[model samples]
Target chain A: MNNEHAEVMEMHMPTEKIVGQTDLYSIKSSTVRTPDAMPRPIRVKAREVNVFYGSKQALFDVSIDVPERAVTAFIGPSGCGKSTFLRCFNRMNDTIEGSKVTGRIELDGADIYDGSIDVVELRARIGMVFQKPNPFPKSIYENVAYGPRIHGLASAKGDLDRIVETSLQKAGLWNEVKDRLHEPGTGLSGGQQQRLCIARAIAVSPEVILMDEPCSALDPIATAKVEELIDELRENYTIVIVTHSMQQAARVSQRTAMFHLGYLVEEGPTDKMFTNPEEKRTQDYITGRFG
Target chain B: MNSLIVATLLLILIGFAYQVGWSRSRQVAPAGGRLHSRPNYHGARVAIWALVPALLILGLWAFFSDAASRAFVMAQLPSDVRAMGGSELAQALSRIEQIATGFGVVGEPAPYESAAGQALREFRNLAFALVVAAAAGTGALGLYLARRRIAPRLRARDEVERVVRYLLIACSVVAILTTIGIVASLLTEALRFFTFVSPIDFFFGTVWNPRFSTVGAGTGEYGLLPLLWGTVMIASIAMLVSLPIGLMTAVYLTQYARPNIRNAVKPVVEVLAGIPTIVYGFFALVTVGPFLAGIGDLVGLDIRATSALTAGIVMGIMIIPFISSLSDDIIRQVPRAMRDGSLGLGATQSETIRRVILPAALPGIVGAFLLAVSRAIGETMIVVLAAGNSPYLRLNPGEPVSTVTVTIVNQLTGDTDFASPQSLVAFALGLTLFLMTLILNVVALFIVRRYREQYE
Candidate 1:
C-alpha cells in the first residue's frame, strides 16, 4: 500500500532534477561574464568581518557583497562560518553571550553594528529562517500575525488579518491551511510548519531574508517546495541562504560564495563557480573530492 | 532460632550453594558444546533457589510460631482454666508464658500452672528446632534440584531475570500496599467516627465545639465548615502572596539573569524550601506575628498576634521556593528555538518572553501553582503555630482562625480517646485533606500532560 502511494506521489510531482544527477554541472565553463553584466546594486557589504565565540575565532576576516533582488548562497562544509556570517547581517550574533563580532557589516550603506543601530529594528528589516522548522506553539493565524502585531505594522485588526492572509498565500501554504487557521502551527507537517515559519517572517515585510540551511531537516519533496519558494521570494526580498548541499546552492542562488576554514575561497555567479572556479579548494569542495 | 541467626545461616548456605552450582555447571558442560548461560547465571540461580524456600519457611514460622505455642499451651491447660472467660484466660496464658521464659510469677502458682509452664517451654524449643530443620532441609533440596537442572541447554539467565523481575515487582507492591493500607485505616476510623456524629451534621454544622461527654450525651457539634473555611482562606492568601512573586522570580532567573548569576541565586532561593517547616513556624510565631500586630496597632486596627494573615504570609514565604524552582524549570523547558523564533521576528527579549515563552509555559506554570497550593494547604507546623486555634467561622484575616490540619493536631494530641467523636473526627479530617491534595495532584498532572502533548 505504501509503495503504491509513493509511486502516485512521484507521478504527481514536477519533473525537477534530483540531487546527484549528471545534468547538475552541465553549465558550460566557457560562458564567463564580468561584474558589469549584472548591474544590480549591492544591498549588503561586508569588509574583513571576524566573529569570535569566547576566545576562539570562528570566522576570520571574511568579506563578501550581496546584491539586491538576488539569492546569495553561502556554500561550504560544516563549521565553515557560513551560518555565522549569515547571522552577522541581522546582528543575531549579538544575542550570543561572550561572542563578539569585529569589522564592518553594512546594510544598504548603513553599518548595522553601529552604536546608533537598533538590533530589534535591524532584525525586523532583515528576517531570518532557521535550519529547523521552528513554529511557535500557537495557532497558525497567531503565528503569522505575531510579527506584524509585534512591530505594529497593522493599524487595525482587519489589516493584521489581511497581512496574515497575504503572507500565508505568498508562502504557498494558505490553501492547505486556510481552513484550519485556528489549529496549532506545530500540528502541521514538517514542511507545512516550515512554510508557516516563512509566512511569519514575511508578515513583517522584511527587505532581506536570511535562511540558515532552511531545508536541511526536510525531505526531498519538501526541499524542492522550499527552493521554489526561495526562487519566488528573490524578486522582492534579498535572500541569503547557507546550505551544505552544493546542488541546492547551484539550483537556487544567483550569486554563490564558497567558504573554507573561515575564509572566502571564491565568490561569483553560480554557473561560473560550479563549472570553472579560480580556487582549487572551491573546485575540490564542489566536485566531491574533499571538503 | 532468632531471625538474625537464621539469616546468617541462610547467607552461608546460599554462598555454598552458589559455589557448588558454579563448579557443577562447569563439570556438566559437554566436551565440544558451549553452555547457554555463563557460570555466574547458574550460580545466581542456585543461590536464589536456596534462599527463597528457606526464606519462605522462616517467614511462615515467624508468622505462626507464637500462635502455635499459644494453642499448645491452651490445650495443656485444665478444663476449668481453659473455660475461663477471655480476660482471665489471657492472663493465665501470659503468666505461664512468663514462667516459661524464666521471669517467675509474683505469687505462688498452682500445680497446674507449674506443670503447664514446663510443658510449654519444651514445646517452644521443639517447635523452633522443627522450623529450623524444615527451612534448612527445603533450602538444601532446592539447591540440589537447581544444580541438577543446570546443564548446557538450561536457560539459567532467563530464570534468574524472571526471579529478579518478581523481586522488583514485590518491592513496588509493598509501597503501593502501604498507601492502600493507610487509606483503608483512615476510612474505617472515619466511618467509626460517623457512628457517634451524624455525617450531615458533621459536614454542614456551623458550630465547631467538641466537648468531652458520655457515650450518648451528644454534647459536641463537630462542624467541618469552620476549619475548611479557615484552610481555604489561609491557602488563598498564601497563593495571592506567592504566585506573582514566584512567577516573576522564575522569569527573571530564566530570561533576564546571566548564567553565573542564575546559577548562584537559584540554589540560594531553593534553600528556602530546605528550611524546616517547624523553624518557619517558630519564626512566624515569634517574629512575623508580633510585627503584623504592631503594624495593625499603628493603623488603629485590631490584629491578633496569631492570625490567619500571619500564618498565611509565613506559609507563602515557605512555598516561594517550590513555585519559583518548579516554574523556573518549566519556563526554561520552553524550547530555545521558540525563543529564537520570536527574537528573529524583531521581538524584544521581554516581548518574546511575554508573548511566546510565557504562553508556551503557561500550562506547566499552572501545574506548578496548583502543586504549590496543595503544599500550602497540607502545611501543618506553620499553621499550627501562627494560626490561632479559634474554631469560629470568620471572614476577617486580622482575627484568629483554625484550619483542618490544626484541628486534626488538636483532636489527636493530649490523651485522646480514640473511640470518641473528638478523636475519630481527626481521621475524617485527614481523609478530607488527603482527598483535596489528591484532586489537586490529578489536576496538575492533567495540565502537565496536555502541555507535553503540545510540544512532543
Candidate 2:
C-alpha cells in the first residue's frame, strides 16, 4: 500500500487528541463546503455530544449533521455507542433516570433543550419506530390513528381517515391490512406489525424519523422491504437509523457515522467510508478486523 | 353396619387384586417389551376399576332405600298406625330406628311397639344383605372384565384416561352443584320474604324497621332503601380514598422508585392488606370512630362514634394494597418496548407515562376498580363494628348508617321464630347482597376481558 493510504487508515484514534489542538482556520475550512455540496437543507446539528449512563460514560464528544430529505446511518459494534447517539437525537436518555447528556443539539437552529420548547411538540415533529415491532394492543387503524388524535393533527373523522390511509400507504402496509384495519395490530405477523408501527409514527407527519435497529428483528425480505421504504421516506423526511448490518447502512444511507467505544471514529460520505475510509478503525471495523 | 363393613372388605379385596395384576403385568411386559406406561399408573388404573362401580352402586342403593324401607317396616305395624299421616308414621319409624340402633325407648312401647322392633330387626338385616350383594356383584364384574382383557392390546391406558376424564367432570359437577344449591336456597327464602314486602317497598321504602312483637297484630315495615343507600355511600367513599393513592404508589414503585426503596416500601404497604378486616373493625370502632366523633363535636356537628366514615376509611385502607398490586402488575406489563418507543419519539418521561402507560393500562385499571368495589361492598367486619346498628335513611357520611351485611347479622344471631319478618329479613338481605356482588363481579370480569384483548 502507498504511504498516503496507510496514513489515512491510521488517522482516527489520534484525531481526538488533535481536536483540542486544531487551529481556528482548520475547523472553519473543514465545515464550510460540506453543507453546500449536500443535496438538502441542514435540519439538525450536533457538536461535542457526550453521554453517560450512571457510572459508565458511553459516548465521547460526537458531532454529526443531519440533512433534510436524506438518510443518515449509524453503524458500529455492540457497546459502540451507535444506538446511544441515535437516542440522543430524540433526547430518549431522559427516561433513564441517571443518564446524563451534555452537548449542543440544534433542530432547525433552535436548541432542543431550551425552556421554550415542549418535548411533546418536539416529539410530534420527530417520530420513532423501535427495533422490535411494538404496536398497541389496539386495532391497526387505531394504532395508526393514536398519534394523530393525541396531537390533534386530525380534527375531523374524514381527516383522521385520510391520515390513517396516507400513513399506511407511506409505510407500504396499506395493501396487506387495508381490509382488516380493525383487526388487532398484534394479530399481524412480526414484519407487518413493525410496518404498522411505522404507519403509526407517520400519522402525525413528523419532520424527522429516528429508527433504532429498525430491521434487526426482521427477516431478510422484511428488512429489504423496510430498506426500500427508508429510501422513499428520505424524499419527505430526514432519516437517522442505527444498524449493525454494514450492508443495510450502505444500501440506505447517504452519510454514514462509525462509532467505537463511545467515540465517533469516523464520519463521511458512505461510498468513500466503505471503499476508502479515512480512519484505520473504520476500515478495520467495516472489514471485520475486530468488533 | 356389618354388611357395609363386608362391602368395604370386598372393595379392598378387589383393589388388592388389581394392584397385584398390574405389578405382574409390568414385570412380565418389560421382559418381552417395556410396559405401556409407568408401573404406578397401571396400579392406579386397576384400583379405580375395582372401586368406582362398586362405590357408585352402594351409594345409589343407600339413597333409594329411605322411603321403601320405612314403608316396609311400617306395614308390619298395627292397622291404624300403618295408615298414619307422614308425620305420625315418621315418629313411629324414629322409635324403630332408636330401638334398632339401641337408643333406649320410652312411653310403655304400645301395641305396635313390638311389631316396630321386629320390623327394624328385619330391615337392618335386609339392608346389610343388599349392600353386601351389590358390592360383591360389582367387584366380580370388574374382575371378570380384567381377566377377559388379558391380551397385549388391552390398552388399559386408554381406559384409564377415559376414567380420569369422567372423574374430572364429576369433580367439576360437584362444584357446580354446590353453587346451584346455594343459589336455590337463597332464592327460596328470598321468595318467602317477597311475599310480605313488595319488591318496590323492599327496594325503595327508605325504612328498615322490623317488628318482632310476638303478637299477631305486629306488622313491621322493613325496607332495603336505607341499607342500600348506606352501602353505596360507604363504597363510594372507600373508592375515592383508595384509587389515587394506590395507583400513584404503584406507579412510583414500579417506574420511578429505586430498587432498594421499592423493596423496603412494598412489603410495608402490603402489610396493611394482610391485616384482618376484623382487626381493622375494632381499630375503626375504638380509634377512628371516637376520634371522628370528637372532631365532629369540635366543628359543632352531631356525629356518632360508630359512623359510615370510620368503616369506609378503614375499608379504604384495607383495599389500597389490592389496587396498588393489581395496577402495579398491569403497568409493569405495559411492554418495555412501548416505553422505549415513546421515549424514542422525543417524548418526555411524564409525557410518555401519561400518554402510553396510562392508556395501555386503562382497561386493567378499570378492572381493578371494579374488583375493589365488589370487595368494599362484601366487606362485613369493618362495617359491622364501626358502622352503627342504626338503619335510618340519611346521606350524612358522618352519621351512623347500617349496611345490609350489618342488618343480616343483627336479624339472624338468635333463636327467634323463623316465620317472623325479622328472622326472614336476613335471607332477604343476603339475596340482595348476592345479586349486587354478582353484577359487580360480572362487570369486573368483562373489564378484564377487555384489558386482555389489547395484548392478545
Which candidate number would show the highest DockQ if scored against the true structure? 1
In order, the B-chain TM-scores come to: 0.95, 0.88
**TM-scores across all candidates?**
0.94, 0.75
- Cα deviation at A106, candidate 1, in Å, is 1.1
Cα lDDT tens digits, model 2, A1-291, are 345435644653333322222232243333222322556778999989989998889987888899888888899889989888887777776767789988988999998877797877888888888889998767899888878777777878999999999999999999999999999888998888888889988888899999989999999999888888888888799999999987777778888899877888788877677767787777767766557
- Model 1, range A1-291, lDDT digits (tens) per residue? 245434533444434423333455653222222222566899999999999999999888888999998889999889888999999999888788889999999999999989999989999999999999999988999999999998999999899999999999999999999999999898998888899999999999999999999999999899989988998898799999999988888878889999876777789988788877776567667766555
Candidate 2 residue-wise lDDT, B1-456, digit = tens: 675686568667667857765765665574567666555556666666667777777778778877766777767787888778688877888887777677758876765776677777778788768776777678667765664454444566777789999989999999999999998988888888888778788877877788664645665888898998889888988998899889999999988898889999999999999899999999999998899899999999888888888888888889999999999999997888888776655455676688789888988899899999989998999899998868998878988899999988888876677777778778888988999989988998898888787765
* TM (chain A) per model: 0.89, 0.87
Q: Cα miss at A196, model 2 (Å)?
A: 6.3
Pairs of colliding residues, candidate 1: none
User: What residue pairs clash in candidate 2, if any at all?
Assistant: A9-A280
Model 2 local distance difference test score = 0.81
lDDT of 1 at B35: 91
Report how far residue A186 has shifted in candidate 1, in Å. Answer: 0.8
Scored by lDDT, the top model is: 1
DockQ of each: 0.63, 0.36
Candidate 1 lDDT score relative to the true structure: 0.89
